[model samples]
Target chain A: MKKRKLFILIEGVDDKRFFEKIIKPRISSVYCSINIDTSAQTGNEKIRRYVKSFHKMGADYIFVTDLDEKACITKKKNDIHRKFRVRQDNIIIVVKEIEGWYFAGLSGKDINKLGIRGIINANTITKEEFNRIIPKQYESRLAFLLEILENYNIRAGKRNNESFCYFMNKYVSP
Target chain B: MKINKLIVKNYKTFNNLNISLDQFNVIVGSNASGKSNFLSIFKFLKDISFSGLENAIQLHGGPEYIKNINTKGNKNLSIELNIDFDIQPRLVLSMKPDDQLKENERFEGLGMTFKELKYKFEISFNSSRKYKVINEDIKFKGDLSKLTVGESQKIKEDEFHKGSTITFSRDPSGKVTFKTGAIQHFIKSMKHTQLPILPMQFVKVKHTELFLLEKAQELGLSILPPIATTIQNISSYDFDCKASKTATPISVRNTLESDGSNLPIVLKRVLNNPDTKKQFYSLIRDCLPFIDSYKTRPLLDKSIMLEVKEIYQSQYLPSLLLSDGTISITAIIIALYFENNSLIILEEPERNVHPALVSKVIDFMKDVSETKQVIISTHNPEVVKYAGQENIVFISRNKKGNSIMTAPKNNEEIQVFLENELGIEELFIQNLLT
Candidate 1:
């Protein structure tokens, strides 16, 4: 049997790493036959173009982007869908930023290991808050983040973090 | 010698990459995608052979900087090259953390190590960051019947050695003996364990009593000679020639300098040789038609100043007065004409030049590649277009932030896009090549 091809477009190398190293390993059994085409982060314009082009080429994809301080998830999702002309279900907007999802997915112990203590809300974590906690470097911070996630066996799904899990369950898995 | 394959691991940006080479290779990537880092591999090898491993690492901003950041704790950075000589010989060199050398080893100056096996070679650093040759082997390409008695004994001893392979310096007269004059010559040639193996010039391979050296004029061992010649001839041009325009002291130079600061001297030398001068002028005229002529004038201080004459003007103006684009193009033309049967790695030839001239440069580079191997690192669409899909290696960072190298021929979507819809440049601009 031929596996269905699922294309994924994301904003940066970190997001791509999350999908490949973190999410893919955990869901391989369920999505056994599906082929995933994850693109290197080329920027927002290229991501928009790729989403449209991949759709036209007869491959379904999930366009992942940050909410970028947007007030409402619905508004961000609608804007992305209308702008890129992608299906509403195919768009996954990370609240505030992808770091927020990372914070949400990791347990209190894992968060403490990352040097953050007493974090009340992971979902509402802003980019600034994340940057304050773990500064960025020329080397992707995600390399370190993925290492932490792997050590704890923390899966990137709805149970750990809602937005990431939603995309995994709804689009990534068979 | 042409490199057929290259494998790099734990090097900057590259986690583990294997790239096949072509006569003319154009490497394109986004910023920080490791295009220049990839080209630096050639320079790195040349530097190691020329100035030993510690100096090479130090010159390149230390081991910490050269080693890939994403590599987990204590992983060794390695580069393996398969060069097509008489027979394909694979050379592997790995740099490991060197915090463990003994006090005596530390005091034993210029820490560098080299290990050689029949077709395999390894070099690593001791605990004190000093390099030492750990293993050396010599294996023949064909059947065991071809092996001399000494060569067979050496192989057997190598197979039985428990620890690391026998070091050539430490075991000068160990169990293994060899009849292959070249292998014995290489083993006996090592005067110190601290010296690097690749820099045959300093190591004095030419003076050795190897059979190949005795018959150097006739029989050619494709492997060693090409590796030596290519390493010696490897030239890198960053095209920063602003300092060359000034009236600098003139020194006789047969080859162009890396930064082109000696452009006047090299240009003078080229003009003196009629064959090279004609080709240089023709290339310049083709690439920059506005120029009537260029010459060097000796100043009172014995320094030489370059002068360029515009076609419309009768009086020649100083080279310092010319635009950056003209000087850059002229330097490139000179480099292309002078370097013969060598590998040239150029970084971002499109910088500071007009698009039309950039195309001319690419065309000239293509022409040069017929006689010599040329690898260019560029982000220009025109260069990528002119080089075509087959000659280009697209480099991108994988999800793990590791630099991955890919070619259009290996990419199905890129092939489909090239065949059906857009050109290579369009596909590149759309970021579809990844």
Candidate 2:
């Protein structure tokens, strides 16, 4: 008998985090024998490539992606299903928005009472500086970054912060 | 050519896992045993394979957002998909945050790599990762990398090339050349079709479902269309969708863009092209029996505004005159009327269409998929049922939130239970298993 495999996908870590922090601890036993994973798009060219692989797999698979940041994903997922002949239930997704992000900033009584920290952990301008391009809320990302730095433990010698500096380096001289 | 196997390590959902697929694999689990997340790997690898490590991180929002946080510390996420394309070609991709730090987007820089055994291709890079093309192999492969860097150099088998990596082909001559840019192009070919989706700040109210319908002609993995609608008027310019919100008539003009955004322009050109005007009338009649004969009288040609009338009632036009599905249908007709092999990817084809028309719309898609690959991403069972198992692909997430084709059981009990609960019909076995 083949060991059944499972694939879980998502747009960001929020989904992974929430499920791990909130969902998993609750339903630890019911879901088993499931080899699961999550991922998001790198970009378009790569998306097509993966779609091809999924089709070639010719087994049951699922694809979770957003809709309409550029155009609709309706066709892309469908194309994979048709080519691979996978089951419809295997292809699931949250429609146009990221389902987990909504859970990130969730407010009101439950949040305050639960002692849930805000998802955005870092607030430094360092994040935007690395993009070479920047979004308006660069400072806001600090809330998210601070959490990252705290958990990551950056060492001067052990840590090479190229990704931390890529966009920021654009404006600053070496 | 089916994927009967999968192995993953330190991925988003699984710490270490392996699984096999049934041809018609239906992954049914509680809301979040990593169902949706399990299915995300394909999208992730697709983004990376087709674009590169850099673009994949950006499209995914950021690298911090991608790395799995479970089990402590940073772990390299790896993926291997064994595919049988007549001959089995194994594609493995792996990545993690770059050791170097930058900014949020750039600070989220990652090291991504791809390995395809068929082509013996392997490419890897990070925020500062660059390829040092070997000179020896370049001569044998021909001007593959010359165009990328704009300079070429010579190096003996014993000598190393500066800024250039050395390549020694297996050919008898033992030629010396640098690596060709073929790796880049091969990776670039891995693209996001059916439009890539990024998490938005908000949810959409009237969100569209990208439904898969056959063009009734396409048979391959490609997304080409089966039929092309020939429009009589090519020079009519753009289309104007002047129909109102409450109750307005649909108007067609000279040309309509594939998205049907040009309905407004089509409304403007109705006066010049009688056939277009007639077609517009017929469409209104089919969609809105309340709409009688209507004419496009230019209120302002520069602004591209027109008046619509139905004998008893006359009103200024807006998109609201038609129901959401009616507009979509009109959009489909208008877009299809003039396009060729240009595959139309609809988001939620079931939306707005009456249940009666839903089946027809699907039939239309079935016809289209024959000539062109009509790929759709939908959760609606109706759409799924319409396209049949052969056209449906279920998506879910794993615990760590990586994507997978078949739902990961995490263990044996869940798999047995799912099979028992879902009743993997003998019919399903036929579709998914050989």
TM-score for chain B of each model, two decimals: 0.73, 0.40
List the TM-score for candidate 1's chain B: 0.73
Q: State the lDDT of candidate 2 residue by residue for B1-434, as single tens digits.
A: 33334566655555655665433333333344454444454445444444544565567655444545463654444444443222222211111233532232222111112111111111212244232111111111111121111123331121111222112222212221223234333334432121111212221211111011111112221211111111011111112333322222344434555335545455455535778767756754665555555343333323443334554666544444544665566555544343442333344445456765665666656655444434344444455445554444444444455434443334232234234332222112212211
Off by over 4 Å in 2: A1-174, B1-259, B266-301, B305-318, B406-434
Question: Best candidate per lDDT, number?
Answer: 1
Model 1 residue B72 CA deviation (Å) reads 3.5
Q: Quote each prediction's TM-score.
A: 0.61, 0.34
lDDT of 2 at B333: 51
Question: Which ten-residue region of model 2 chain B has the weakest summed lDDT?
Answer: B207-216
**All candidates' lDDT scores?**
0.63, 0.37
RMSD in Å for all candidates: 15.1, 25.7
Query: Top TM-score: which candidate number?
Result: 1
